[model samples]
Target: MPSSPPNPQLAKRYISYTVDDIARLFGIHRHTVREWIKRGLPVIDKQRPLLVQGADLAEFLRKRRDARKQSCAPGQLFCLRCRVPREPAGWQVVYRPLTATQGTLNGLCGTCSARMCRRVSLAKLTAAAGNLAITTTQAGEHIDECPTPIVNRDFKEG
Candidate 1:
């Protein structure tokens, strides 16, 4: 199997690529290119060396790439284990700020109980929260501001 998906941009739209040409371009085996032809990748005609139009190849690859994407709706978080956008359990979410302008909304998946979180800009946090009740968690003080050494800042003696 190929290490990674082939880039659709490598196919020049106007050119026609033979099986071997496409295999070399994508760094996959020539038989794998033939397998792609069998799997609905279009070919010029039923000739000896199969000819695939670059535009068709690019379009096919683009569709494959897009089909694998899972986008969350306004109130949902993507669950890694379930591989779907899911509502948080109990309609509650916790917001922990990572920066002055951005934070993460953390919750448990309604379906699987797997931890789910989404990074959102502070400006858009309300929109991201949608109908869910959200609680904002305060960030820890910076080391210099703390009387004792901060957990993440350093272990230097106060």
Candidate 2:
């Protein structure tokens, strides 16, 4: 999905909208607006047309955009397969420099064993490396390390 434009002024122009109105304004199908309603878009359902308040829609969209903008903490990477932020299993992280100031942190998800990666600033990574067992490598270098065994006892086998 394309990222939403960071325009707060556009959201303030309307007080309320119908599904058709929203679809027309956003250049999307009416069915897509209905789908958004199904996915927790607030609506005033007391009347026949089903009104969506502008303030409610703005808040919903802002929260959705913010969730997509989430960044991992210093010791975590986002696990694509698990769809959550996770720490590398056993602190076995690999850092590969992408540029002078940026790099990628690669590791395995502690729970699912899926490859997890996050882009990080080189300065922040260097600070984090002081406390974690991280292997540093040049840009584009592939590490052939096996997945570490899960150490968190709270994780259950599926």
Candidate 3:
């Protein structure tokens, strides 16, 4: 039978780690450690000389590290066109409150800013429709119609 060697990384230290220490060691917030304590995670010992087991800390740290590694970074937008990170060339940000009129913001980065804009064309606000071009009649009736542009195809017959 083969014998397994000891894991030097799991060495027990003679120091008492506070909630902060546990959080820092595990790369978690201090409040999380308190929550874990409240959630009844097993304590190694509650003896006169208080000490936490290295095994318990190691287990917690391993789980947290794995979760963090698997998660996506914050505020990362996936581009629909390229299927990667996107930087929108032109975008507008506006705060449309339920009880108030929309407020527009200036100088905000289009890539990272919120989307809220009245898309207008030819001196008129655009109304929602299926990819349509807008035109005003002589009698001032807004006709929502699509402009069918001619497509020229130079297909090489093989």
Stretches of candidate 3 off by over 4 Å are 1-30, 39-41, 45-51, 71-158
- Per-residue lDDT of 1-158 in model 1, one digit per residue for the tens? 45446789999999999998988887777766776686678999999787999999999877655633656778887664564668999988888887899777888899999877777899999988899999888876321121111111111211
Backbone clash count, each prediction separately: 0, 0, 0
* Ordered list by lDDT, greatest first: 1, 2, 3
TM-score of every candidate relative to the true structure: 0.49, 0.49, 0.27
lDDT winner between 1 and 3, please give it.
1
For all candidates in order, the CA lDDT equals 0.74, 0.67, 0.33
Worst 10 residues of 1 by lDDT: 146-155
Candidate 1: what lDDT?
0.74
Residue 97's lDDT in candidate 2 = 78
Candidate 2, TM-score vs. the true structure? 0.49
Count: clashes, candidate 3 = 0
Query: Which residue pairs collide, candidate 3?
Result: none
State the lDDT of candidate 3 residue by residue for 1-158, as single tens digits: 10221122442455456666665554456555555555443466675333456666555545433432331122222222222323333422222222123221111223554321222232222222112232223322332221111000101110
